[model samples]
Target: MSSDPFEIFLVATPGLEAPLAAEAAGLGFEPEIQPGGLTVHGHWPDIWRANLMLRGATRVLVRIGAFRAMHLAQLDKRARKFPWDQFLRPDVAVRVEATSRKSRVYHAGAITQRFERAISEELGAPIAADAPITIKIRIEDDLCTISLDTTGESLHKRGHKQAVAKAPMRETMAAMFLREMGFDGSQPVLDPMCGSGTFVIEAAEMAAGLVAGRARGFAFEQLAGFDVAALTPLRGAEPVTRPATQFFGSDRDAGAVRMSGENAMRAGVADWVRFETRSVADLQRPEGPAGIVIINPPYGARVGNKGPLYGLHAAMGQVLRDRFAGWRVGIVTSEGGLAKATGLPFQPAGPIVAHGGLKVRLWQTGPLGG
Candidate 1:
């Protein structure tokens, strides 16, 4: 509501900050890369746009203000005087969360309770366990920073893909990986192990010029002075230009293939994407120009065995090498040995990203030799 610029933080998965920052920059924002995210200074509409368009961010948080509070009494006093009316509505239920590091206010629970009391008693807002609006408080070295989560649900939800395969990749991470592999939606993307069709669907959406958050709502809608009429133009559909090449996905399991197709359909990309049941050994390059081939193959952590995974990776490498000439390859796996077993001339492995409680890296290669 205020005309002043708010510090907008785009939360990224650990180890993937650079690409997310690049994404923000490409979208015409000057983003400063932080430890786990990127920060940009912008007005309220910028916060809304980030939540709606950024494919790599997990959530968008707007920094309201900060204060130095040495004790709980100071924290409580300052929180009571803080102008919560600018951002929050008294009619809306809110949730308060807190984290502390190297600060006197060590107990996060007590910090949460204090803020909850301040907002409820002073600002006349109700605190609820299942509130869609979240106020995040972080205390570090005696400095307390208040932020609001503008994104109600994680951006990866994307309001589609009701069906999922085992160990499915999040859509946010998939989009970042696609960007990391130099995909601009100009060429085809084929995922031989496309569980739930994340990569293919994301590529199709990007090619179709679809907004990532178009299908969902955000926490900012619940904020005070949120002009829905002013925000409606940002949500307008862009001209959809179908890509010249089709995005493709395949899996050995018939059920997985079926699920991927259904997910693609829900994503509104079924027309530009294709899903089929086929094994890696049976993979054949599509009859078109060379493109990117990315796969999140089964790793030791996912399948509980490293022995068989090596052969699987090797077979994948063999098929790609023998059939898909002039195509780049990207393989996401937690084990370096498994990536090496592929025998592809992989460039340096990408950042170690945290996925499903396991650390994984992207092993990529230049165009395969004929």
Candidate 2:
């Protein structure tokens, strides 16, 4: 609300800071790298652009302000005096979460309660943990910073997939992987290890100029004083399209293949992609010159077998070299040694994401040089 540029934070995978920052800059806001995200100072328009274009971010948060409090009394007084009506509505339920370091307010629950009371007393809103809106509080070195999560559900839920496999790729990760692979989706795309067809589906959607946020609702809609009508027009824009021979995917598990088919239907992209069931070892190249190929094979930790996964990687590399020359490949894996076992010339990619507590990296190759 203040004319001062509001601080916007974009939470992203650790190694993806550069790409996310570049994306933010492309949207006309210079972004700086923070611990777990990218930080940009901007207004509401900038916030909207971030939601519209960011491919690597998990969530977008706007920082209202920060205050230093030596103790609970100081925290209470400052929090109570700070304006609350600018964002909250009396009818909306809201909750607070706090983290601390070197401050007297060590207990997280106590801090949350006092902060909740301040908001309730000042703005007359009840604290509801199940409320749609969540206010995040961070207390470090006696400095308290408050931010509002503009993205209610994680951005990964693109609202298209009605079903998923055991370990489907999240929409956010799929988008980032596409960018890392230089995918504009003008040419052919394939995902042989496509569990739920997320990569292929996302590529098809992007190629068709479908805006990720267009089909979904955001937490900002519930915030006070939002222009719902303006947002509606943005989401209502028509989708772009091209000929339908571009995207394809396959999986070994029959159930996964069926689930992918259902998901593609729900995403309205069944017409855009071809799905089938085939083991990675038996995967074949598309009947075209060259394009992008992405694979999110089962990591050992998740699937509980490292020996066979190594064989799958070797077989995948062999198939690509022998049959898919001139094609570019992007492989997502959480294990460093296993990625090396593929025996492909790969460059270190954007980030190492925390998927199920294991570090994952995107390993990519240029067009196979025969």
Candidate 3:
């Protein structure tokens, strides 16, 4: 924990690096995307803020140390020597994950075993693979680096949604979708194909001035000398009142509608949003002036069928065009053919962002006008 802004890494869905870096910069962090993730130069406070505010990031990592190790022994020795007292706690459980390339520690399992033993024996820390605290290791050629996952569960979990549909929305992707649409809290936001209500929940949270990290406990809290006290003000800050009808979500599936409503209640944003069950074709335009309409419909892979999705896209596009005049529209899909099937003119706006190994892009129309 040197005084200098520690090197932090933000792992995301590949093509999302640019947007994630832009998000980091917006949060006052200096971020640069490297190969696997974005590297940010900042202090612990900056790291905390990134974990709290970065909606597009999968994980926030603080680079504890990096070194060149020619062999397994060197890796173990360096691993043990890494001032574990600063990050590891004797009472807490931790997990070790490793990846390798041309390095001598070529076996990920072997690397995890050795590193796990080093921490347990040298630092007197316990090891638990399923634990909240995780130590991530990456070995590219001869370079080995170690980082700590400050955000235990993925930021997408948001501590809500005990139930979801077949293809629910990921919080990171949902946030990115909203960002692409330039969604600010000022106007009404809608998600007609709301699924489990992820987009509406995220929109409401943003509108209500809620910090994404406030509702959940982070893995970093269990680490040694974790300044939970320093975070008191953040946790105690007055929760934003649910804005009146600023956010709306609907799904055709009645079960999904019930689950979304429950999830919103758990997230304490029920008042900020309205949830209903309706087919995408029947989606009505918002009563207020033009606003943003975002949708993450089933991409065929998750729903086990794509035959009806084409019709869904067409109907959604028609609704956006005929009913929601003067509003912006955004849709996320991994299939370009289906996107084009919408029949509404749209331009692709993304690099191939990786999601579960499938590359997805956002399709957007210019201004929603006749």
Q: Give the number of the best model, judged by lDDT.
A: 1
What does candidate 3's lDDT look like per residue over 1-370, in tens digits?
5676678889887777776777778877777789767987887767777777677888888888889988888888888888888888987888999999987779898889988998899888889868888998999988998989988888877766688776666888887777777777777888887878899998888778777777777887787777876776665234566565568889888888898899889877888788898887788887877777887767887667899888877777877788888888777888887788777678756677777667788887776766
**How close is each model in CA RMSD to the real structure?**
1.2, 1.9, 2.1
Model 3 CA lDDT for position 289: 71
Q: Candidate 1's error at 18, in angstroms?
A: 1.0
Clash pairs detected, candidate 3: none
Candidate 2 lDDT, 163-203, residue by residue in tens? 87876678887887787777866878999988888999888
Residue 297 of model 3, lDDT score: 69
Which predicted model would earn the best TM-score?
Answer: 1
> Which segments of model 3 are wrong by more than 4 Å?
240-245
Model 1 ranges with Cα > 4 A deviation: 237-239
Cα lDDT listed for each candidate: 0.91, 0.81, 0.80
Q: Could you give candidate 1's per-residue lDDT for residues 247-276 as a string of tens digits?
A: 999998999899989887777888888888
Candidate 3 lDDT at 49 equals: 75
- Summing lDDT over every window of 10 consecutive residues in candidate 3, give the lowest-scoring window: 236-245
